[model samples]
Target: MTIDSDADADRERLRELIDELAVVRGRVTLSSGREADYYIDLRRITLHHEASRLVGRVMLRMLDEAGIGCAAVGGLTMGADPVATAIMHAAGAEDRAVDAFVVRKAQKSYGMGRQVEGPSVEGRRVVVLEDTSTTGGSALTAVEGVRAAGGEVEAVAVLVDRDTGAAEHIRETAGVPYLYAYSKSDFGLE
Candidate 1:
């Protein structure tokens, strides 16, 4: 298959998984504090045995396609944890040198006093990953924390975009490219 077609197939399978597992249909308030008819709780997929590999493959493809080369990938803790680790595993499978880090909401009070943890993002190009993004708060915060830890902000990427202004918000606020592996339309929502 052609490269584009292969990418399309990967995306299709990822979407199928989301539709079957991650997509929650009902009233819900997102972390961004907005009410929605449907919510994409990507953890359900990102933590799954099969779907996690798919998440890793799809997101790694997205980054390579964007010409975004990062030595490390991660973002604000809970939401970004699995996504970052998945990407790291994917890169490892390809023999790519990629590490994963975690960005804490705040610096710890003691014991090395770190806000960014893992293989040391110090002076490395890093991409911030989010499971789902809405207003861009979590991603932006991660970008800030990474920068403070001396990591170069390569870009911010999300597994799923809620399409609630995160792309533009991150662009305007962080001055970095914002990318998503899937969007509201990918899940056949809205």
Candidate 2:
């Protein structure tokens, strides 16, 4: 898919911002129980006002370019909230009108009692999102939840891919497109 020169330039600038503000080097344990010499705290950028806008723009552009039609964008709560909200607002600003949803780690035993909150995803095409991907565990949870709720997972998008084979895992397991805005090497990691 072709991107406009202006959007491409913005993407480059966003990459610089992410590399400068998000990537950190040190021994750390990831959510997937893996040890790494460097960690990517994408929330540092995904939560930033300006950075979030750029992220939304880039991600939405990617969805548009890929020609994937979806009724909504969503994923597990916390990390996916900002990305999905940003995408929803950005799409609204452009008159695209996509909805957003948040998936709970566990179902609440109350009113609605649903695992996914927000608009109904049943029978809808949805894209799962994440702030950062390590082993694809969280994204997989989201994908499974969406499917179990009768939503078709159109794809998975992440702010950063640790290049640890999660993308392949997601594709093999979910049989859906996997996309990321950046990778470990994007921040000069090995």
Candidate 3:
């Protein structure tokens, strides 16, 4: 498949910016109950106005390239929130009209008591997003929630895959394809 040079350039630029602004060297514990010598705090870039816009465009392009015409983009909250929203906005700008949903770690006790919130994904194809994945636990959790809510998980996309068996695990456990926009090595971190 041929990729547009402009889009390729944009992806390269976004990658460089993320490496400069988000990658850090330090000891940190990840949400997946793992420890790492370095960390990729994508929030630094995902929260920035211009960087966020770039992320949205790049991600939308990726989905297009992958031929995943999902009805929605979503994943566990906190991390996936901005990414999904960005993807949704980008898709809308392209007239694709994809919505964004967030999966709560636990269903709310009051009101709707819902786990998946946004547009109803029942019988719709969806893509799960994550900022960074180590064990794929969080992504899989979102997958389970989405499935329980009657959505078909077409794929899972993580901003950064830690290469710690997340992709393999997600596929093996849930039978869903996994793709990462970037990986730890993209930031020069081993």
Candidate number with greatest lDDT: 1
All models: lDDT?
0.92, 0.88, 0.89
Write down the TM-score for model 2. Answer: 0.95
Q: Give the best candidate by TM-score.
A: 1
Query: Could you give candidate 3's per-residue lDDT for residues 91-112 as a string of tens digits?
Result: 8887888999999998899999
Candidate 1 lDDT, tens digit per residue, 1-190?
8978877887888899999998999999987788999988888998999889988889999999899999999999999999999999999999998999999999999999999999999989999999999899999999999999999998999998988899999999999999998889877788
Q: Itemize residue pairs with steric clashes in candidate 1.
A: none
TM-score of candidate 1 against the unseen true structure: 0.96
After superposition of all CA atoms, the RMSD between model 3 and the true structure is 1.9
Score every model by TM-score: 0.96, 0.95, 0.95
Query: Worst 10-residue stretch by lDDT in candidate 2?
Result: 1-10
- Candidate 2 residue 2 C-alpha distance from true site, Å: 12
* Model 1 / residue 121 / CA error / Å: 0.8
Provide backbone clash counts, one per model: 0, 0, 0
**How does residue 34 of candidate 3 score in lDDT?**
84
lDDT digits (tens) for residues 50-168 of candidate 2: 88898888889888888887889989988888999888987988898799999998877999788988999999999999988888888999998888888999999987888999999
Q: What's the true lDDT of residue 103 in model 3?
A: 98
